[model samples]
Target: MRIVSFGFQTWGRKTLQALIDSEHEVVLAVTHPASAQSYKAIWADSVEELAKEHGIPVHLTERADAATIDLVKQAEPDVIVVNSWYTWMPPELYQLPPFGTLNLHDSLLPKFTGFSPVLWALISGAPEFGLTVHRMDEQLDTGDILVQRSLPIGPTATGTELVEAGMALIPGALHEALSVLEAGTANWRPQDKTARTYFHKRSDRDSRIDLSWSAVDLERFVRALSEPYPRAFSYYRGERIEILAAEVSTVRYGGTTGRVVVQEGGGAVVCGPDPIRGDNHGLVITRVRAADGTEHSGAEFFTRGGYLTDVPE
Candidate 1:
């Protein structure tokens, strides 16, 4: 089938590559211009370059403008496929093709519908995260499902790892969706919006550590914001420090939340909620990075034994 692709960053590039390798024809590619945002830079693969290398038509735009719509209309694709297109897509654009638009979102539909889905899923403690190819609708990711693929989230899985795993699913899932579409046997399933969970884009503020959370949650937070993405961070001694590696402490200690109580597990035991009861598992910060860009073991860095506050002390 003839296809038109809308995407951005590494996710977009991978989707375009899969479409190029498939039996379908990718007639046009629409992608956003480069971004300077921290998150956007992490997976900074060039969709425009790949499309151009293959001699497919490429249009660089932040969103689907009238001219982009006209370009798609002229391309006259049989179907439209989108991934990581960071803007609202009007119905006139998505519904232009006969088969409508097939969006490849990096999460299971009816959950993790918006930006940074893999990160949000890991932070939310979901056992599994996956990709879904669904028909586009008026709402964001509230479309009918055509194909779905999932991967188990291990206890030690990081956000980067889960993202790569999800990207690997694109080839199989896209191929399956296209096959069904070609055979006219696509079994589209309606999403239960009641189970839908949408997450906003991640920003610097989202990485700030909140000591009120349980140690397990904080540990997961650190892993969710693992390298390439912003590390979970807090302030200590009026300086910013990024938590690069952490885990739940095996011991419980009582103290005010954020207090650097004791050393344990080759790291510093930082108190969380319910400290007075002495039943809380403190967060064991194993590794950290200072504002000056130096890395240090948590135990070595927190030798002064202060508190990790969300704001400067």
Candidate 2:
């Protein structure tokens, strides 16, 4: 297939690379400029660089502008493949392709429809996340599904772990979708709108740990915001402390919510609820970074305080 591509992250780089590795012809690659939102390119490979390596024309823009639309028309690609795109795909550009626009979303269509799909999936304690390739229609991830495959998330999977696992799955997922795209006999299915879950863009503030939540729930929350993303955190004596690792204890630990119930070596047991078992429980924090940017044992660091709470003095 003659292809035009769009993407702005590592996922996009991988997707475009998949096309290069395939028998299809990639005529153009559109990536993003290093704007404020994408300054974190430390984790992202250069799609533009990769495209040049493959002798493909590259364009860096927010979206398909009038000039870009003209270029897409000139290319007359068989299909337009997109992944991790921050901007909308204009109908003028997507419709220019013979096979239409195929978007690769990280989560199952209708579920986690918008930004941070994987983070929300983990936070919700979902068993699995399905990678989906769908026909784009301007709506955010509400397009007809072209190809999808479910990937299981372990009970204690961290955000970084989940991301790496998804990255490893993408090459195969893209290949599978490409096979369907090439045949031009894709089995497209409309998404069930009632089952959809969408998440908004998140910030470091969103990583704030809520001590009042159940141990199991907090553990999931912490894991969802763990390394590669901002670590889940809480305030101590008006100072921020990031929690890198913690364990859930189903057995009750006596103390108020957020209180340091027990401290031993690197682990500090904090009070929590056993919402599932209908009993009190605790979260044992094993690793932490204090407000001063110093790493410390959770037990040793929290030993000076009896409780960790948002309550005013």
- Alpha-carbon local distance difference test for all models: 0.90, 0.79
**Candidate 2 off by > 4 Å:** 36-42, 263-278, 311-313
Clashes of 1: 0
Q: Model 1, residue 87: displacement in angstroms?
A: 0.9
lDDT minimum window of 10 residues, candidate 1: 261-270
lDDT of 2 by residue, 1-313 (tens): 7889898778888888888988889999988875545224435778888999989999888877898888888888988999988877777777777788988888877889998888889998889986888889878899899888788989878887887777676778778777887877678899998998888888766788877677788889888887678888887777777888887764556655666644444444454554334356677887889878899877777767666666332
- Going through the candidates in the order shown, the clash numbers are 0, 1
Q: Considering every candidate listed, which one attains the maximal TM-score?
A: 1
- Please list all clashing residue pairs in model 2, or write none if there are none: 110-196
lDDT of 1 by residue, 1-313 (tens): 9999999999999999999999889999999999888778889999999999999999999778899999999999999999998899999988899999999999988899989999999999999999999999999999999999999999999999999999999999999999999899999999998999999988999999888888888899999997789889999889999999998888877877788854674455556656899899888898989999999888888888888887998
User: In angstroms, how far off is 173's CA in candidate 2?
Assistant: 2.1
